[model samples]
Target: MTVVQITLRKKRLGRSLAGDIVLFGLLALVGCFMALPLVFVISNAFKPINEILKFPPDFFVRNPTFTNFYDLYHLLAGSWVPLTRYIYNTFFIAFVGTAGHVIIASMAAYPLAKRKFPGKTFLFTVVVLSLMFSATVTQITNYMTMSWLGFLDTHWAVIIPAIGSSLGLYLMKQYMEQIPDALLEAAEVDGCSEFRIFWSIVMPVVKPAWLTLIIFSFQGLWGAGGAAGSMYIYSEQLKTIDYAFSQILSGGIIRTGPSMAATLLMLSVPILIFIISQSSVIQTMSTSGMKD
Candidate 1:
C-alpha cells in the first residue's frame, strides 16, 4: 500500500480507538453511579450501627459485624405469625404465578406467532399497546374485577392477573417467531396434536424466553403485594414476605441496621434466580439452531 493510504488508515484507526475509549469511560462512570446505592446497601448491612449512622455516612464499612442479621432474626421470631408462613406465602405466589404465566403466555403466543386467523393481528396490536400502560393505571378497574370474581383476599387475585401479562406474551410470541414453521408443519404431518407439538417441541426450543419470563414473573410476584395485595389480603397469615419486610423497615431508627440486613436477605432470592436463569438463557440462545 502507498504511504498516504497507510497514514490515512492509521488516522482512522486512532480516531476509532479514541472514540471507543471515551465511550467505555462514560459507560463505566454511569455504571458506577448506578451501582453506588447497591454497594451502599450491601456494605451498610454489615456495618456497625455507629458506623452506619456516623457523620457523612461512609460508603464502606469501617467495622463489619453480623449483629444486624442476628437482630433481624430475633425481630422476625417475635412476630405473631411464624416466619415460615410469610416465606411460604411469598414462594407460593412467586412459583405458582410464574408457572401459570409462562404456560398461559406460551399457549397464547404460539398461535399468535405461527397461525394466521381473523383478528389475530388486531389482538397482538392490542397486547403491544397494553405494554405502553402501567398496571397501576388499571388498579380501580382491576380491583372491581377481582371483587366481582370473588378473587379479592385470595391468592388467585395475584396469580390470575399475572397469567395475562402483556410483556410476557409479547416476548414469548417474538421468540416463537424465530422457531421454524417447517418444524411445526412436519409435526402436524405426523398427526401430532397442537398441544403435543407445543409441549414437546416449541417449549424446549424456546427455553430462553420462558426462563427470562420466569425471572421477570418470579421477581415481580416475589416482591409484590403492595397496593393490590394489601387491598385484597387482610389476613395476616396470608401476607407476603414483602409486607412483613416493610413492617420491619418501618420500625424507625432502632431497626435501621436490621432493616438493611433484611433488605439484603430479601434481595438475594431474585438475584440468585436471575443468575441461574441467565446461565440457562445464554446456553439456550447459543445452542438454538434451526433450518429453513
Candidate 2:
C-alpha cells in the first residue's frame, strides 16, 4: 500500500482501538456501580463489630468469621437469629403472595385485555383512578380494612391486601394484550373450556409476564409489607426474615459488622433472582401495549 493508504489504515485502527477502550471502560464502571454495595456488604459481614465503624472501612476483613451467619440463625453459644423459622415464614409468605398475585392479577387482566362486559368502562376508570394513589398513601385505610376483616396481625392480613393490588393486574393486562386473539379462538375451537383455554393456552404465552410478577412479588414481600403483618405462629417461628431483621434492629442491637453481613446475606437471594428475572420483565414490559 502507498504511504497515504498506510497512514489512513493506521488512523482507522487507532480509532477502533480507542472506541473499544472507551466502551470497555464504560462497562467496567457500570459493573463497579452494581458490585460496590455487594462488595462492601461481603467485606463487612466478615469483619468484627468494631471494624465496621473504623475511620476508613476495613476494606478487607482481617479475620473472616462465619459467626454472623450462625448468630443470625441462633446457632451459636450466644445465638440470636431464628434462622429456620425465618426462612420458612419468608418463603411461605413470598410464595403464596406471589402465586396469588399471578393468578388473580392475570385473571383480572385477561378480562380487561380481551373481554367486554357491563360497566366495563366504569370499572376500568375506577381502577385507573386508584392507580393515582399508591399503597403508602392508602396504608391507613388498608390497615383499618384488615382490622375490620379480623385479619389483622395474621398472615392472611398481609396476603389479602397484596392480592388486591392493581400493579400486577395492570402489568398482566398489558401482557395479555400482546397475546393474539386468534390464539384464544383456536383454543376454543379445539373443544377447550374457558378455564382450559386460559390455563393451557393463554397462560403459556405469558410466561415472561408471570416470571416478572413472581420476582416482583417475592422481592416486595421479602423486604416490605409481604411478611410484615403475618399473625400466625407468634414467635421467631412465625415471623418472616424481614420481620426478624426488623425485630433485631428494633431491639437496638445493630451489630454493624454482623448487621452488614446479615443484611448482605439477606439481600443476596433477591439480587440473584432479579438477575435471572430481568430478561422476562424487560421482554414482557417491552411488548405490552396500553389501551385507550
Candidate 3:
C-alpha cells in the first residue's frame, strides 16, 4: 500500500477507537451518578450527625466511629438476643428464601413450560396474573390464613409465603422454554431421570436466569415484604434486621446519624449485590425467552 493510503487507514482506525472510548466514558459517568445515593448511604453509615447534616453533605466522613453499631444493640432494651442474632435471623430468612425461590419455583415452572398436565395452561395463566399482585394487597387474607394454620407467630409465615412467589416461576418457565425438546428426549433415552435431566441439563442452560433469581430473591426478601411477619416473630430472639431497625428508630427522638447508619446497614446487601451482578443478569435475561 502507498504511504498516504496507510496513513488514511490508521487515521480512520484511531478516530473509531477514540469514539468508542468516549461512549464508554459517558456510560461510566452515568453509572456513577446512578450509584451516588448508595455512596452517600455508605458514607453516612460511618459519619456523625453533624457531618451527615452539612448544607452540602460531604461524601467523605470527618469523624467515623463504631458508635452506631453499639447504639443499635442498646435499642433492644434489656434483651439478651444480641444484635448478631438479628443478623442471623435475617440471613437465615434471606438464604432460605433465595434458595427456595430458585429451586421450588424452577421445578414448578419446568412442567408448565414443557410437559402436558391437567389444567397446565390454566395454571400458568393464573400464575402470570398473580404476578401483578403484591403481598400487601393480600395481607388481610394471608394473615387470616396464618392464624388458621397456627403459623401467624412464626418465621415460617414469611418464609413459606415468600417461596410461593409467582415472579420467579414465571421467569424460570420463560427461560425453560428456550431449552430444546431434543435435549430432554436424548436425556431420557440415555436413562436420565426427569429430575436428573432438569438438574443437569435444564438448570445448566438457564444459569443466567438462576443468577438473576438469586439476586432478585435476596433483594426482595431484604425489603419490606420479608419483614411483614416480623410483627409476629420479633419476640427478642426472633427479630429480623428490619424489625429491629424500625423499633430502634421509632422509640422517641433518635439522633439522625445512628438512624441513617442503621438504615444504611439495612439496605447495604441488595445495593452491593446489584452493582456486582447487573451486567451478567442483563445479558442472560435478554436471551432467555427465545425459541431453540
Consecutive 10-residue window with the lowest summed lDDT within model 3 = 225-234
lDDT of 2 by residue, 1-292 (tens): 8996899888887777678899999999999998887887788887766676677776778878877666655522233544675677677777788889889998888888888889877877777788899776887787788778887666766777778888888888877887788877877888999888888877877888889888888788777632353432344445676666655654444544456656886788888889888976677655653333
| Candidate 2: stretches off by over 4 Å | 1-25, 58-63, 74-82, 225-237, 249-254, 279-292
lDDT of each: 0.89, 0.73, 0.79
Model 1 lDDT per residue over 1-292, tens place: 9996899898887777678899999999999999888888899999989987889998999889999999998988899999999899889988999999999999999999999999999999999999998888877777798889999888888888888789999999999999888999999999999899999999999999999999999998888865545777888888887788787668789888998898898888998999999999999888886757
- Model 2: residue 57 alpha-carbon error in angstroms: 2.2
TM-score sort, best first: 1, 3, 2
After superposing all C-alphas onto the true structure, candidate 3 shows an RMSD in angstroms of 5.5
lDDT for residue 270 in candidate 1, whole number 0-100: 95
Superposition error at 176 for model 3 (Å)? 0.6
In model 3, which runs have C-alpha deviations exceeding 4 angstroms? 1-15, 56-60, 63-66, 73-78, 229-231, 252-254, 275-291
Candidate 1 TM-score, true structure as reference: 0.87
- What TM-score, over all chains together, does every model reach? 0.87, 0.78, 0.83
For model 3, residues 1-292, the per-residue Cα lDDT tens digits are 9996899998877777679889999999999999888877777888776776787878878899767666765665445667777788788888888888889999998899889989998999999899787777877777787778888666777777778889999999987887899879999999999999989989978888888888889888776433564554646676687777766677654556668777887787887888677887777666655354
Candidate 1 vs 3: which has more lDDT: 1
